[model samples]
Target: MAGPGEFELIREYFSSRFQTGAQAGGVDSGVVLGIGDDCALLTPPRGKMLATSVDTLVADVHFPASADPYRIASRALRVNLSDLAGMNAEPLWFTLALTLPESNAAWLEPFARGLADTARLYGITLIGGDTTKGPLSITVQVTGSCDRALRRDGASAGDHIFVSNQLGAAAAALPIVLEEYEPSEVQQQQADAAFYFPEPQLELARSIGACASAGLDISDGLLADLAHICEASGLGADLKLDTFPIAELAQSMSADAALETALTGGDDYQLCFTVPAKYLDHLQGLQLPITAVGRMREARGIDCFLGGKPWQPRGTGYRHF
Candidate 1:
């Protein structure tokens, strides 16, 4: 079906989907002002500091236009939230900058609904933004407040590395999107869910706040994201591929494909962090299902080992260049 023009699309598709009030569709849980306001106002609970992050999802670059608009909208916002979660922050407010070739009310409605649902879950309020005619792309900048912000460079040489949940599901979805292979029904569901509705691990971040010294959401896969921590801490990491929390879905793929996808492919969005040995018990006691995939080392190079063998990947993580 052909899409509708812009203004009608926004009004019909977007306007009703997001109601700006605590009582209205639960969007205003902590929001002071919502939707129609010139700007949104929000105050974090006392004593917390704020951290902000901006992420852009471009058409063709981030997702194919054929992708579901609702999923796209949710992902656009959640990915930004993932950044905040990595910092062990509480989501507070957000602003969106959206560009589209044309508007269709049908598309915008579900998109706004998806955004509202995810925002409500994170207690984030939408403030102000600009809508313009252009190529299809979305940019969301989110603000989160925390008692203490986690930094990427806080890892010490002796810290232990941990990752939340599993990896490589998003990368595995690429084959489905590219139609290179037909995924089994279960695999298709896993891949599509990974691509569309990724959880930002906010609960884990809140639970591990002060205990987490250095952390980042793994948008660029394990090898690449861990390298960021390694570079930031001025140290090295020896990642044990066998210890990586590879998902059951990923395991169904060929061993080589799974390894490459887990190591070099991007978009996993799980938290990779360091905890001091002293807090190891607290971390372990939490029983968060995190695995010690690697450890911080005194050396200054990033390395990975799989099956007791060196894992040398030809390419690093996702590089726009």
Candidate 2:
């Protein structure tokens, strides 16, 4: 194949592929101009607020450098979308900045397909971005809209704490992802899904809506992330360790090991939120996969109880520094 120039590469693999999403738009959806221009023109809904987030994933640091191109694209976009979900926002549009060592058509084809498929599934459009020659890295900036956005500082004492679903799967899957541990076929599938196709909790956040006092997606460990909520809300939390919903991927580990991972291991991407006492019943009535594992307190720090006794985790959370 001929060496693809930057403009041709963008046209073939990005702009053209992203147009499918534009055609699927509704009357109220935004996007006066998208890819092919120097900038994207957008129209936010009349009364809705825009929620935007950006994430940069470098090769080896975020995912395996030798991983599948398709899965890489999926993980990259979905993780950014998780941020919008954390803020209780609906998907709108996103920009992609891709840095590559070389423009290999074989690689770009699958990567583009993966990105387009995910954008299509999430109902988000590809706006505009830049391409550069460098070591592999993907930077995605997503913008969404919301009627009533969730905030980190909205909790108070006597509020119930909840997580959208089971935790620690992505953390537990790291070993399998790095090939440090060999797993059964089913276990391997579980690991791949956890690490590659993590679901953004958009619907659950939408369901929680006005009833949620505070919320954030669990990119960090449960305890570490819960501390964020505590810090933001200016309150503490008392958690029941026994009530944690562990993921099946981590269930095969020793009980203590599993609990430790669930508490300190990061990358789950599920939503951790608080509901005031008065809204507890309303939140529960939604019948989501949420569980109240703790309660916000008047104290200024988070405390954990296992078997009715104080418990501690091995670590706080992942530190980039």
Candidate 3:
């Protein structure tokens, strides 16, 4: 059984499907040329800075290889979109670099639909990409624009730290996702949603961008990701462990374990940002799930205090190496 060739696969699955509506010949998607050309032409909005990020999710590494293709695509795109959100960037377009061991339509149909649907959901267009024969992996490079850029190097001592929504759900869901644990139906659903459809905090980032001193998405985990802001801004943080908003999915675990997971687990995709004291009232005015759990310090590393005493985690966070 011979599969479709490269060009045929592109036409059937990607090109024909994405080249519709405003994206048709770059009418409204800011594309001068999309797909089938040597390069993609795009127009960045005037007076706004361009922000771009790229991520590669390898099968069985970043995600379970046997997971649903649709969910995989959604997780892939959503996490990348989180990068834009952390920087308060508005997503404009993206390029996909898909490497597959073989071209299978059963996989391509839902995968392409997943990509297309997520793109539409985010109001981003697929401009161009490359397809190659290799191990299953998806690499997406997202480009966004920012009228006001929130960077990682702007934090200072006395700034407060916050995370959008809850944390540790995805890290807790890993056991269910890997079939190591069988949870109740509701827990299973929560697991799937947390791991497969992690929401990017774009609106929250935009809401606080004007006052947030520094920000980044919590892909690696709260402690590890916050360390990045510390390193970049040359300051440390002290987290109020008791005030931590542990996710319901993670709450099923033991109290100590859940808190540890919330602190050190990865894939939350929430925003961990620093805010000046001046904007605390402004942030409180918004009806969002922003939680202030820490404050930047004059020190050089993260400090965790629980019950007014120092606490430590078994591990800092997920490490690729």
The lDDT of each candidate is 0.77, 0.86, 0.86
lDDT for 3 (candidate 2): 35
**Model 1 ranges off by over 4 Å:** 1-15, 21-30, 314-321
> What 10-residue stretch in candidate 3 is worst by lDDT?
20-29
How far in Å is the alpha carbon of 205 misplaced in model 3? 0.7
lDDT of 3 by residue, 1-321 (tens): 123577356554788888833454335557877776778877668888899999999999989888899999999999999999988999889989988888788888889988988998888888888888889999999999898888899999999999989989988888888888779999999999998898988888889999899999998889889999999999999999887999999887787888988888998999999999998998889867888999999899998999999998876322321
**lDDT per residue (tens digit) for residues 16-115 in model 1:** 5555544332333356665555666564566767889999999888988767888898899989999998888888778878887876667666778888
Give per-residue CA lDDT, model 2, range 1-321, as digits (tens). Answer: 123576466555676767733453555567777776557777788887899999999999999888999999999999999999999999998888888888788788898999989998999888887788889999999999988888899998998999988988999898888898779999999999999999999999999978999999999788888999999989999999887999999889888888888777788899999998898777777789988899999899989999999988765322321
Candidate 2 clashes: the total is 0
Least accurate stretch of 10 residues (summed lDDT) in model 1?
20-29
TM-score of each: 0.88, 0.94, 0.94
